[model samples]
Target: MTPSARRRVPAVHDALADLRWLINPRRRLLPRQPLTSSDHAPNRCARSSFVSETRTPGQASDYEYVCIITFIKEASTTLRRQQQLADMDEEVHGIVIVGGGICGLATALALHRKGIPSLVLEKSENLRAAGGSIGVHVNGWRALDQLGITGELRETADNVTEFHDVWQHENNKSVVVPVRGELRWVKRKDLIETMAKNIPSGAIRFGCHIADIKPANPGSHGAILTTLDGSIIRAKALIGCDGGNSVVAKYLGLSPPKSFPRLIVRGFTRYPHGHPFGPHFLRLRCNGLFVGRSPMTENLVNFFVGVWHPGGSVTKDPIAVRGLVLEKVKEQCSDEIVEMVHDVDTESLIVLTKIWYRPPWQVMFSSFRRGTATIAGDAMHVMGSYIGQGGSAAMEDAIVLARSLSRAAGSGGGGGELCEKKIGAAMAEYVRERRLRVVRLSLESFAMGMIWATKSMLAKLACQAIVAVLGTHSLGHTNYDCGRL
Candidate 1:
């Protein structure tokens, strides 16, 4: 035989021997421990020791049967060792979600509620909850209820009863609009921790920075994610809940969210003796700038200042930003509001960032999905905080995405091919359901952002006319029901 044919003989023999062992009714189970753990090294050594003891004394050492048995043992060891190495190279997951923020945690909890498991990859070493506070309107509360976390969060903040709007440009005119539904300013950290606590342990893997994302090989449905550490993660369904500058969004060919040339600084202030502002949401628009304040609790107040800087550039130093915010606050706000801004806790001030939002057209026409991979939260439709809907919209995405995936999985559970096809179809359904809802929000926020930034008298009058026609309470987007998971 040729040299190549001689080498093939052992391979063929090993395959046949493995086939025999697979069919053996009394194959040694005790010696064949799982090869996925650290203990496998010692177990393999123990299995090798068994070969000598199982020998037949009456048979010669050169017997054909003895040679075959010895070769089989050696082949099994080699094959198992190779398998262990391959396992270390790749990790297979059912649903892999990127980001561990509110939206990501909410998605995992929502899936957990539907009996579907998922894995969350967070690039940060800890939760990204340092952004101070977020306002949760009625729609957000509804989504939180579906996640079974509303009650616990309710204890952290009280529902706002009224919205106080003061137009300083119009002779400091005050307009008090009664809040129609639940509105609460919740600490971003509280929301993250509460949702995370409900999810299964070990579901979230931190410090996993994704380096690249691509479609799985042809005939496969899902995505292959490579982390910064070079580990490969194969996900049957990949959900990108990563925020504004999402890597997955770019992979899906989505443009990054555009900045609105507005700088916003949000933070919390403590009143040890109890704050005088009751349950109220305050909005003051003055001198082409905006200042907002709301009571999270009797003693803790949350506030934000919006400044229109043409270049969207602001100082990165915390001290410098604080000084700038205070200087701007004095130019356009009352003594009380200025005092509140000055009293903001030193460490509570979030770094200044430009307001960002996806355009309505982008929200209307983006594919949002490729195979079984899709996006959620800010990655899908990042709208400005002008409408107080960014956080609520992310929660809404979590519920709808989870619900769609659960239904598809339930209907097609028998085969890998069927399940993959169903998952892709499910992603399509999720995008369809969320597209229109997010578009309206994006458009409204975009318009409002322009109105806030424009210095033209004609523009301000037109904005007033639109607001007058729609009425403060007539904005029905907040009354939306995302339904149960």
Candidate 2:
């Protein structure tokens, strides 16, 4: 056995093997193979099924049984110990929703509507109210409808009836897309609060940092989540809505989010009464830059400036960040654009975000679920915020994932005989239903970015022609409907 293998096998074996099974008749049902010294070779026999051919099955039958049983017993005992470390872990969950972002909160609401309880573990100390505003398109509203919060939300939300674009049109004209449906602007915090409203009290656990995930005990069902603060949680299903760099996505073998050579500075400006940004709102295309502003309310306008910067970090100082954003807007935009940003309060909420996009082709061609654990939203298909679909997509994912789990739970209660297969199939269905949409949106985001950066006049003209005629409102991007509530 290689020295490395010698060091690796025992720990895993100790964590997964069921000990009392050694004395149970079912123990022999578990296939066993003689462990040769070679089993200890570094990186050897790491496959799900660890076995060796060098030794015959009959080789020292008694000794083999003892060794195998002892190993499994140790693993089972170890798992039990780890699971018992926290008081909260005493009660296993039906499903554990990771991340408290839009996706997570929406999923919880979706599940609650179906009468299924879930534990939503959030890494943040509380709901996040930071970040730029969200442009919840028509399709996004479908999800809120299903979650039963759309009407109430609309009461406080600002309806954006116009769509205006700067840059491509001559004379610095802003073409408003003629799209039929409306887009609403909401501060990120307000949007999250709206979702949190529907989540049953005590359903969300705040300040829980998920450190790692592991396969749960075979008959036990679900996955095990180890938190940074030291808690182990087991659930029948593990859904990852954490974010682009999701721990669950990583555990499920998805690639890391691809970073773009871009960064964004976002904030909201408030007018004592109202601002004259226009009903259509404002989106501008600058050669190599993208900037936009939308009215989040009668008095508050939300804005974002995307700039190409090789440097990885945004300006550390909010004041400095604001300066950089204003400079970029003036440099890439017309004088009208310069004035739009001028009155922004120096103390406005300014957030610097590094740009990143999920790989579309990768998600399109691959499977999305492994066992009961699956992913949605940015965790599955993060993209640039150009299309204003990022939050919408997360909402859609929640609907789909919730429907899948509800079906699984309904088909067969959490019985050991059928739980794994049914829940796994449901997760697979979620992947199927969402994969193509994810591919389209992800690639579309990148394509839009390319158009924003293209210096070709003809190309820019062609792009304008499409948006102008369709009214970006009718551009058909918002033509999405998350299947029934």
Candidate 3:
């Protein structure tokens, strides 16, 4: 036998020794039963039956032997087949990730690197770019780095260095506060496109609406997803990178908690030559509400206004919405700002309703991993975008989950009797390790929003005074360590 094969025997022996310890904690170490090629297939191996032992007749000392039968193939072959069977038993033909947005694409690329294939299902027939402009904090860049797609993402994003100019309509003041650290501003479409380029064209299945999802089989790690057209697709894992109104969460019976009391209007406008805003810094104006501008590109400026809107207050008509936004800006902002707001093309405006929730976040599904099915990204924990960790958190989930699965697959277990148990344990570990951090982040974002959206003049003045004393050093630093994921 080859040296490598020779080395494998002791390894297998050691593994079996460890398995015995795991299966029976009270017993002392003992030699494992020898395994052969035919005894390892699922449903073929003898079910674990009771074994009794007695003294041998000829030997001077009493010795015990218990007959425990197990099916065996080559250890390596058995491992591979177990994984395949696990996949089969879970009813997971391949991974089916819902949403073709940033989180969905990132998860796909991460899985591909591990040699796992996946299909992305998007509800929209055409990739409609919404959320006109968005910012990627440093944590987001770290996530893209892990996916090996940061370079491509950077090419389409504007690297923001400073954020100082604060426009205050309440007091007609423009206070400059230094913003430390790095951030990137990009068109939302650009970020999506960058991720899409890394994946094969056929990998994304648009116009597929997932209506329902259920466990593929009892005690299995896969799920059966029923699409709108009544087509059933079995996926080993189901990642819900779908946005705020995720159907996956609903199907899983997770209802979003209510937290915020405001509506957000976002859009893009061409920067008129000689505009006061600089290309390097994000400008924020707080009057009765929050208004901010970030550079989308050299000639385009992305702007947003967040105002108090009792749930379902914003009109559906785009023109009326624009007018209402313009009115708000006019009431508190200077003429220069007013002119810019009016200049924005009505068709380009994007309006999103902002919602919030508290800590100790709960996953809509009781089981994160079942048979062969699991979920990640927004479908797991959807939070406010105040601190801009939404996308970053989702990417972290993908990396952590993929790593866990890869490690489990590398161990001889794969997806067999013991393997499923291992994967399930790992998923539980993930939730335990990740739940508190993401929940804390969500709570922090909610608190920050409250501070920014406070209507009390005394409270706003107190906030400004605190910032003046503390400086802008505390503006946007998140405590999360993305590198660990």
Q: What are the models' TM-scores?
A: 0.80, 0.76, 0.70
The true-versus-predicted C-alpha distance at residue 49 of model 3, in Å, is 59
**Superposition error at 261 for model 2 (Å):** 1.6
Worst 10 residues of 2 by lDDT: 11-20
> Any runs in candidate 2 off by more than 4 Å, and if so which?
1-91, 168-174, 219-221, 312-314, 331-336, 345-348, 413-418, 452-474
lDDT score for candidate 3 against the true structure: 0.63
Backbone clash count for every predicted candidate, in the order shown: 0, 15, 14
Candidate 1: segments with Cα more than 4 A from true spot: 1-87, 415-418, 454-473
lDDT of 3 by residue, 308-393 (tens): 76565566566677788889888877786677778886777876665655333354224444444555676666666666777777
Residue range 1-485, candidate 1, lDDT tens digits? 46576355643443444445545656633245232212222223454433332223222222234545767798899999999997889999989999999899999999999888899999999878777888888989999999999999999998898889988899989989877689898999999999988999999999999999988889998799999989999999999999989998988999888877777787888999999988888888888678889999999999988887887357777667878889988887778888998888979887656777888899999889988889999998887887888889999999999999888878896642227788999999999999999987887777787687778989877765655554423556788899989
lDDT of 2 by residue, 195-229 (tens): 89878899999999999898887765478888896
* Top lDDT prediction, candidate number: 1
For all candidates in order, the CA lDDT equals 0.82, 0.75, 0.63
Model 1: how far is 475 from its true place, Å?
A: 3.7
After TM-score superposition, the amount by which residue 356's alpha carbon in candidate 2 deviates from its true location, in angstroms, is: 1.1
Over 4 Å off in model 3, which ranges? Answer: 1-92, 165-180, 272-275, 280-287, 356-372, 412-422, 451-476
Order of candidate numbers by lDDT, starting with the best: 1, 2, 3
Clashes of 3: 14
